[model samples]
Target: MKLFSCPSCDQVVFFENVVCERCNHALGYEPASNAMLALEPTGTAFTSVGRGGDGRQWRYCTNYDHGVCNWVVPGDGAEPFCVACRHNLVVPNLADAANVALWQKMEIAKRRLFYTLLQLNLPLVTRAEDAEGLGFEFLSNDPTSGQHVMTGHDDGLIVIALAEADDAEREKRRTAMGEPYRTLLGHFRHEIGHWYWDRLVRDGGHLDACRAVFGDDTLDYNAALQAHYANGPRPGWQGEYVSTYAGAHPWEDFAETWAHYFHITDTLDTGRAWGFVVNPRVDREDVLTAMINFNVFAPTTTIANISDAWLALAAALNALNRSMGAADPYPFVLSETVLRKLGFIHDLVHGRVN
Candidate 1:
């Protein structure tokens, strides 16, 4: 994500900012312009206050009332929710304060996912637009059954367990699962990978190309997963798969690799925005040097550039965490085979696959 500034006061702001601290102006993000507008109340609607202002009235998304969204829509538009919130098919009951708080956290991560998707200019359709269009369901575990809600994707609907918003509960699960990294944003990116696999690979007629890289996804998924749990990941799986769980099935390999692609590109973009350059003085071979000066989100950007810069940036990030006595923010290695998988995703996203 890139840094944003308040349109009125020019003070640096964040993506989720609802009020600019410097000028005390009400802020709303306009996705079309990808700008944070400082607004002036105009009856039930608002008017942009500065530089990019066009004098057109705008209204905050309906979800903004719940304090979970800060996006704005054209006042004359019929839609109540902004581009991101419109995909939400189900949300936990907001009447309960605890659920509301958790749901807010879920929305924050979900919006960041959408920001990346929009940046890539990927296809986004609501369930109302297509039968298998992208949608979301933030659900809580059934109180009566005491069954936990699984965070997974079905067709185009991505279900996120509200419990994952709780820091202690999520950390406990992460430790139990032996995962090095886990977050609401990570979950969104991973599950959406499944949705895109359906759109870009399965239905987009790239199955043969994908299979060549990810293996035969036609393998029985349930059997593969069952065996994965019964027996551990295949020996020496690290050389080929992004993670042990990715080795369970070709489908999972694709999803895990897909999620990594997002992770790398987005983090690199942030580093680029900050004008970060890594050139460690002690490096003898210059293997740990990078200049993060390119637009990583560009379709024309080569995967080699991304991979090189990511390695440098990730190494520096891990070192910084160690200095603070914290776990590495990125603990996984990108092997040669995994890089090949990422290349496929890069090509697929840019329609470069033949």
Candidate 2:
């Protein structure tokens, strides 16, 4: 995250600030430019000092009425909504008091989604009225409605139920899935892998390489998922697949690994910014290798493996958490198999393969 400023006093501010500590100006995120903006209230409408792409004026989406966002849309970018807000298809029933709080938690996680998307330069678009493109729908089965609640992804779209925003409900699902760690942001990252692999890997001449690691994604997803649940994974899945369910199908493997790649990159970038590492370059493989002794990403081009870099950071995170009497920050152990996946991800990210 780049540093933000309080537009009122020109003093430095943080991303999640609702009111500037320096000058007390209200602040909200401008998703189009991924910048935090300072605002002055004028009766019903607020004016912000930021321009969207193409030099358009903007303001917070009216959907804040529904509690799903804290973002502004470009005035002349001329969309009816903000970039993040535009993705909504069926929002939850906010008339219910509990749903309002649920929606706010989802917004916080969704904003983090936008931050990573902006940083990675991913393409984002909303599915317009009965039109085709990337889109989203926040839905559920209220018993009043016949449809079942599902958090699933399909054809460049992802559907998440409002209930998943609840911590207890999500923890229930995570326990059922037999996972070590899970969170709303993890779900967002995993689903996004499905969207991005469609753009980055399929039919982009990366199919063969992806197949070698993730398996052929050509099998029927429904069938694979059924088989996975019915019979479980092959005897020892964690030895090969990063996650147990990832071994169920090629597509699942790819999505899981892609999510892991995002996790590694984001954490490394944060570490870089906080001065955990000496270099500030955006690339992870190079930056991480220098700080840790063992290096492995891009072996043909680089000196060696950077396994030690990750280890060092992992140690620091665990130590910090331990100091606070909290669980270790990273719970999973990285075997050689996982490191190879990380290397493949590093290579793919750096255009070493392409």
CA RMSD, predictions in order:
0.9, 5.4
Q: Which pairs of residues clash in candidate 1, taking residues 3 or more apart in a chain or in different chains?
A: none
Q: Provide the TM-score for each candidate, comma-separated.
A: 0.98, 0.81
Error of 2 at 36 (Å): 1.6
**Can you tell me which runs of candidate 2 are displaced by over 4 Å?**
10-12, 42-57, 129-132, 277-308, 346-352
lDDT of 1 by residue, 1-354 (tens): 888999888999999999999899999999887789999999999999887888889999999999999999999889999999999999999889999899999999988898889889899999999999999999998989998799999899999999999989999999998788999999999999999999999989999999999999989999999999889888999899989999999999998999999999999989998899999999888799999999999988999999999999999999999999999999999999999999999999998988
Candidate No. with top TM-score? 1
CA lDDT for candidate 1: 0.93
Candidate 2 similarity to native, TM-score: 0.81
Global lDDT of each candidate: 0.93, 0.68
What local lDDT does model 1 show for residue 167?
88
Cα error of candidate 2 at position 231, Å: 3.3
For residue 267, model 2's alpha carbon misses the true position, in angstroms, by 2.2
